[model samples]
Target: VSLSLALKGFGAWAPTIGWCAHQTQTCILLWAVSRLRPKLCWDKHRIKEMLSYGLGVSASGWVWYLKTLINPLIVGRFAGETAVGQIALAIRMLEVLSFAKAATYRISIAALAQLQSDGKRLKQAISEGMELQLLALGPILVLASWIGPIVFPLMFGEEWIPAMSIFPLLGVTYLTNAAFNLHCSTLYVLRRNWEVTAFHAAYVILFGILAFFLVPHSGIAGYAWAEVLSIVTYVVAHLSIHRLIGSPNYQIAAIWWAGFTIAMFSYQLGWWVVGGLGLAFLLPEARNRLTTYLKHFRALKTG
Candidate 1:
């Protein structure tokens, strides 16, 4: 079967654990919001739009995963199951990072969609979201950057030693990736939907082509590098979209990227202290806004 056909089968054959977890997260958030605001309208068109957004984004994820799964299939058939199993387990571990980044993006989507105005509110929502994402992912990147290799052998077995060289790079790459994904919410909220699709295409096409040529020669390391390069391409495409949409304070982009790097590189001894400081800075603002949201939700429910 063709790769496309095979992927269709694979997607149907067994839902990925990652996909399942993501769907569960999305459903839980939607359910919580609905319960909090019982009167929110949910017509067919609205349901369709929500499903379209979720399914469209879900397909992008599945494309990368299907291709990742294919590599092990090819390896097991051509080389040996031991080689394939090592790569499979390693890839599974790498997927944990991808899912973490994706979950943050998903939250940003719901958060942005709840805000007012397609232009001003969307950008502000995304900016605030970028702050929260950096705060959440910063220490994670720090710990992973330092200990990715040490943890791998214990988690996936010593046979996966080849993955050691790739894991730290993969972790750092997630920092960039999480930043890029924050814009996905912006793209959708502003109705710049095609750009979102285009970037997802860029990620898959660039990664697939690079992996196609490089993996056979360089092994899982090649695959790892391909993924990192693809993430960079994804980030660039989002920046281009910002320009195309009339760039709104490129400072927003700078703040997110620079802040993430600073947070990641700061002294580990004081990182948690810094995180607490950030909460102190943001809490009053966040609390007031959340209180307003709850008031609206309560009014909707009571009505």
Candidate 2:
């Protein structure tokens, strides 16, 4: 079955091609490597350690899968298809946020794992990782929030107009998660895997609980608010676990929250763009960084 579907990918019908191709290629490479290094030693203790790690990974995967998978059912049951559809549509925007986060995680897990025992380096890495996440996702968040209402209604038709309302709040959810997303990786790399899983489990339960109260009363936006609440709870837990495990004191960032609040108010006052641009200057450090980036870009163009 896998073979036929993989073959179908050659004809450009790659429905399940990624998983099939990745597995097949991995097995083939591993077999080749084994044949090339036939005297490879297998350590029982090391295997056991890896197995423990794998178990934690498996639990986390299943827990999160169930969380995401079950969310739609709750939405559909409580809020109906229109709300579900709106949420589903808004989620496509989340993929954009995920891409920014994925890059930060890849670098963070690698760097943090190397510096796990060094308090100074780990702190530096964590601080910088959070900064990079903000740098990457910040402007995107601002632009999307500013433009989505005007764009989504036109882009997806009138039925999806409802999505524009909930999406900005979900963008807030994504932004909140990004603040502590790297901490989850740091916890996992430190072998505090269960903590990460526990955080996610709490997120799932809290989301469901919030959904329970909000969905029936507030409709689709209720689901979005539920997500916001869940993101807040989970990120707080993630950071507390980080500190409990001896991670450096990362300054709880209120800049984004403050800026967002101001922007929302400015938006109400019909000066959203001006207000959002004002955020760049909210912090002296951010202002300097923007100036440096602009200067470098100008230099590059001139030279």
Candidate 3:
């Protein structure tokens, strides 16, 4: 739809039209397959139950979304429209690259909820989920970080090249997100929404503060570094999950994450990319886990 519109010289309306068309199709498909009809009804008790659970999720989501505005508001104020555009481009690129991580996070919520009553299973599930998320994300990040500098200027325009400077930093930030986002999901499954809300609040607040101070001094790259530094605060979510289900052994994942992050940051220096990936792939624990995961996936496919 978008491509057709763009080709027809109506490119400005293509994205909106395409999005509406996709949503309309989804709604129609759900109506046909779900086989449920809405009835006019009112139930105060049910409303109260839903509000109790939903309000926290909504509140946390709203607060979490505020981080998105920091670049526009803070960076725009400190730098200018050009800086904001560069940051926006970098963020859009990350969004596209992080799609798999986002999908897994959503699906894992229901899966984690089923195991909520079993601590051992819950911890194991979180560990496995994190490993798979990293495995899926690592290659995409590496490839993008490697080729983006070369391809982006040609594809987008020479004016957008500066965006690639901070792309790797934001990539590492998303990589860290893949590592710990399931902890947030675990909190939700346990009905600990307020804790998640608190963590998100702190996250936005910290990002806002860092952007405020850094953008003026260091430019957009400062904004990216702020995101990388804010990852340390994920410990709040980690501790919250630990108190409930005990934390998973992240030793193996941590080593790989560190190596991958360095590789991305130094990919321009030539050998860091190979060295970092080599370290991650050669780790005995990571190789064993990957083998086990592949076997399980094959069994599920065949069975």
Candidate 4:
């Protein structure tokens, strides 16, 4: 719907949509500002920092959004709308799965800000956060595999059948992206935004280059492959950043490997049973993480 609105050309809807984004940013800014007191606070400097962080987040989102449109536009025009529409549906699933990590970013930022023991606690938090994210999203990846085919066509119209075929593969792409998000949140909280941009730029470039050849030969599957490859590369770069900042708990490496293995094997299991069980395993982990996160949130509210 948002895509369709944008495609109708910005003349009719740009102002309206732009206003919606403005209102959202304004609300965030106001809320942030309200937390400050004029006499007690470093008002100007803090406001500048808040706005800068907001812009970084917003710009990152905008860049991805532009590419999101560009990729589909080319595919739809050159390859055929059915193929493009199908890929678009697949990408939409990716977006839905990816939102889970947005929460991870918020949580990581809070953790980094409050937890004073940066060396030990920061490492633990990053590990725990990744574990929490994996446990939360692992089964979702399974469910997407099981039901995406049926759901995609129903949601986007039957013209999206090819999209369904490639949908399961793209589920891994989302998983990789979630992992990348964890790395990003940790990095950003530690003040490594430039690294994030560089990591993404390199990954996006490589993925685009791969897609030029792969898309023609493999169609939507190629696109899925490109996404997974790029995200995995970004994840590696993030690990490098973690090391540069300082060693996080080395245990995080093992957990990441284990989580990836679980995700890989689980994807093979038929959606209903395998995905359902994976989610069941995820519940306790999620409960613990959510509880910890909420405690911090409440503390922040009061403090």
lDDT of each: 0.60, 0.70, 0.88, 0.63
Each prediction's TM-score against the native?
0.61, 0.77, 0.92, 0.68
lDDT of 1 by residue, 137-215 (tens): 6556656645656776787677777756555445556666666565766666655665666676777778777776666
Using lDDT as the measure, the top candidate is 3
Candidate 1, clashing residue pairs?
none
TM-score of 4: 0.68
lDDT of 4 by residue, 1-303 (tens): 345567777665866887787799988898798996446556798899988887776665555555575367545555666677678767776677767767766776776767534556766666666656665676676556667666766777776677666665676666656655556766666666656666766776777777776777777777777766666566555565567555554344344434443444343554344443445435665446557767977999999
Better of 1 and 2 by TM-score: 2
- Model 1 sits at a Cα RMSD from the real structure of 9.5
Cα-lDDT of candidate 2:
0.70
Better of 3 and 4 by TM-score: 3
What ranking of all candidate models by TM-score puts the best one first? 3, 2, 4, 1
lDDT tens readout by residue for model 2, 73-110:
88888878777778877787776656968777667777
| Candidate 1: Cα lDDT at 246 | 40
**Where does model 1 exceed 4 Å of error?**
1-70, 73-84, 94-100, 116-118, 243-245, 248-303
Better of 1 and 3 by TM-score: 3
Candidate 3 lDDT, 85-195, residue by residue in tens: 999999999999899999998898988889989999999888877778888897799788888888999999999998999998999989988988788899999999999
